[model samples]
Target: MSSDNPTPTPGGPTRRPSLDETGELPRFLDSATSDEPIGNVKPEGDLAGRRFPLTTGFSALVRNRHALSTLIRRDLAVKYQATVMGYFWSLLEPLGMAFIYFFVFGIVMGANDKDVVPGSDASFVLYIVSGVFVWQWFSAAVTQAANSLGGQSALITVMKVPREVFPISVVFARFAEYLAGFPIIIIIAATFGHGVFGWNLLWILPAILLQAMTLVGIGFMLAAGNVLVRDIQRFLPLVMRMLFYGSAILFTMDRVSDSGLGQKLPWVTYLYEHNPLVVLFQMHRAVWIPGLAPDQVGIMSATFFAVIMMFLGRWVFYKLEPRVLKAL
Candidate 1:
């Protein structure tokens, strides 16, 4: 007459006991395993109590920063090794791009007359350099981030570190390179007779940090997406190209906003204003401009979005990471 049930209370009906209940409180004449608790058996020294694997993603990032930095240095060094130009290419890349763009748009195409251009009083060189300067850093970071997971496919498949680290590290690595190249832009600006630079202009620091956050967020999302759908590699380039046009790459934000074109697409106006890269440009112009320092409103907004995106990105990455590894 015994059943797989807990001993009834003195005045209560029979109830089933939890798996943890003692054998005396539960029994079944026919259920052979009923005496056993159903659960994972513990391994000795389970130093950290077993817990959600998701938190492990962030914990790994914090614990493995040294490993992360080594990966970043390895990536950058791979690009520089055996090249005669070595690190010179980092500073030269944006300079070469600006030169080509200037010759094509400002000199040959007469874009200087373009009202959408800012700093018309300044040399066309300065105006073009500024936009190129802004666009290149972000572009480089995005490109690096997009390919980050794919590049580390081996490390991910072979090792147990957080996969999100690869993409975020790529963004961080490119940001470092961007920072190193920043002096090149300022020196060129000063040499061109367009800027009155000072240490006070260093307000650009927070703006740069905010931009890196946006990159990390978008990079994490894209990297996670790319893990399963390989064609994203193709789609991302097109998206980035469109971003350059939508952002202030070849024009001034004020000119683009005031051109009455944004009126046609009110939603587009909001998106442009809200995008991280666009915010950075506004902040960049404020600091890089001759007399401007930085906009408090712009800095606050950029920092806020940066934080939101970083958290959101890490959340998304952690949530998707388990499935993402399966694909790899």
Candidate 2:
């Protein structure tokens, strides 16, 4: 080698990335910026920070199930640690709500005397409690999930675990609370009217599973989205409140399905019947009460909706992940 053209040494100044290699100078600069905080992610290459497929994300969750469990436990402990009643607070909340709704709608509104559901002897109390249980699980999982990522900014910055685990963990933890409260529903069913055990009772398992899957999907989307838009956190509670009224928590689906409203607004009735959470709630109510069987079509529809939401949430989460990290 000539003196003017020295051979490249083992240790030398790093070469600046070429346009072909970096793709865009601004992106390269953003990546190079020292002020950007280190997070659970480290981006590189052409596909760095790109969206992952649903299968890939789910498999990652399955593979990291232990970490997910730990997160779930930690979340539960932290949430109730300060409270005197601890986890029992979960049962108490819905119990209190059940009483209030039972008094207002069941007594004052004369739901106690009427069969809110056709062909069943279940009172309005039984009807409302059943729906309230489902709502508690669904609403808690989803609302907490919306804050899962943003609330754990410290963990996001330090933990190298799969990001999806945070939101899914919230779902699992709230599910534990749901399970603890399930006995109350069973006791109410047996004490208030019919016995809880029956052939149709087997259907509650699938109903719960389908609802969990749907919530997981919502969790993924909301968790990722809330990281970017704090407005999502503020807006979710109002949405959940609206869902409570619209989901037939206080009334019977049959009323709307067979009423003048149904005749005039057939499309509205269709939407309500097909609403996945509505289906799940009605399925829960049916299996708990005597003389009713869950609508097989509703169960099937809920399953399909859950599958679709899972796909949608996974797609949206991965799509927004790169930007979410930056926003957080």
Candidate 3:
């Protein structure tokens, strides 16, 4: 008598047993296939079809907060591993730059605190050091975040996590380093007789929030764009260098107005006033030098741009993610 199960000949396709004989569908038939749709089963490559609401990216970030913290820790650990004077290097580089700028502008060119930031009692050293510390974070975050996705292609492709985590982690890591240097800033301020305790210190919170928003927005765009076009990673350094000088790191907007450049070239000062970096720098410096506090117009402009860049960055990142994954 023939058995119910069909035996296949060597090198031949086995016939699927009938449901009556097996009492159930074959394993292959029971499983969903690419050609057939199943109830509530999302299609392959469905990311393209999903609606990208304004909160989608932020919601993903919120859901993946633990993952973000892990990434931030890993990045910090990798950055400091196998290095002597690890975190101190972050303080040293900016401190060194502050010294160089102080020498060139304060001594060589004879620019004084009164001349650079008029009406501010803070010494020139305090002014430059404060600006340098913050600028270091800004520069490092932008540079690292731009290349964050490209450098970690292996992790990004293998891990099923939000790609934004990489760039945002870099921003937080650099911000941590920035915060680490605060004691030094405080020491400098105290030494110069510019008391750090004042109502003006309240401004630091909003200043930091605005900057974080700006950097996150910029990071999203740069990280996604770099994956698509590798040239972005190369071109960013040049742009950053230009931004350093134009950002009023070595001087202040007050000095610019005092020099009458705004009158001679109204557009030049207008651009200077509107540049987010300049506005951000002013906000940060205003904490120590209250005279440098930005007017209502500057604050409003910066706030508007920060909001726009954030939403715009998320939109671009979402639009490009599909192509980015393929390119990766």
Candidate 4:
């Protein structure tokens, strides 16, 4: 008869085979007893050999939707922890930014909506507040997502969840903040006498979807790249500063076009209009200032850019995942 336990040697005590000797269990399962460090152990079984498709990030998020939600909640809680105002900070930051910009451009500089925005009766305050609100979400998401992987290296190493969840959670958490601030934007628009109700409001949905898609794609690339090259984390702030001025957040594309530089170099306006954020900000402003909306060609081009970035980001992430794991 055979025994379930290891058999005793003739002269020595019984001993079970180590995972390395047996080669029956996956290497990852042997981490507890293995002499090698956990971080150095390469994954085995499905994790090691599985082939991921281009939709892997999307599919992973969907399959682990519950985990993703829990992560988002955890992030939100951690972010506002020890704070008295908590969630209101999300609304306050962008609102405060709007106030400063309104003071500078609307009052100090005397920027008129009729001339700067053109065809929009909305005041300069509403125009800038609307842009700032959405831009806050984009900026926060990108900055947080870029560091998500490295920041939670220990959790990521231990958790069996999808790696993409880390960056995606940051994106959604900022998105939650974005949604929370929408009411403030509405109140400002209504107070400024900009009509908030109309079929044009439907444009907000696509604008949001496009921005989310773009952010997720950028998040994937930045998250992975930051792990490999630590300089990304250091250098990102400067890039964001440039993007803030270039993205039409504080000024309209029309304002740029009417400027002396734009008039002297017409291609400058063309390049500025082609910026994805320009189109996205215009779409967002379109909710109240319909004339600020991008044309069909601009909309299509932005959509194409979003789609391409998403695919490319996922591919880069997975392709470099092994190296990222080793680095972590």
Model 2 ranges off by over 4 Å: 1-56, 258-260, 290-294
lDDT of 2 by residue, 1-328 (tens): 2222334546896355433344332221223322334444544454354422222467767766776776787788888879998999999998899889989877787765356655556767778887787788899899999999898774554444567888889998988988899888888778865545777787677877888889989999999999888899889889999998888888876678778989899998988787777877877777776444546677688889999998899899888887877666
**Would you estimate the TM-scores of all the predictions?**
0.73, 0.80, 0.81, 0.83
How many clashes show up per model?
0, 0, 0, 0
Best-performing candidate as measured by lDDT: 4
Residues 1-328 of candidate 3 have per-residue lDDT tens digits of 1234575757888765544455442322222211222223222463433222222457777876776787787787778877998888888999999999999988898878776455657788887898899999999999999889888865554344467878899999999999999899888887873745688888799899999999999999999999888899889999999999888888766667656777788788877887777888878877887877888888998999889888888888878876776676
Model 2 Cα displacement at 277 (Å)?
Answer: 1.9
Worst 10 residues of 3 by lDDT: 28-37
lDDT of 1 at 172: 75
Q: lDDT of each prediction vs. the true structure? A: 0.65, 0.75, 0.77, 0.79
After best superposition, candidate 3 residue 273: deviation in angstroms? 2.5
Highest-TM-score candidate: 4
C-alpha RMSD by candidate, in order: 17.0, 12.8, 12.9, 10.6
Tens digit of per-residue lDDT, candidate 4, span 138-197: 999999999999998755655555578888899999999999999998888788747456
Whole-model alpha-carbon lDDT for candidate 2:
0.75
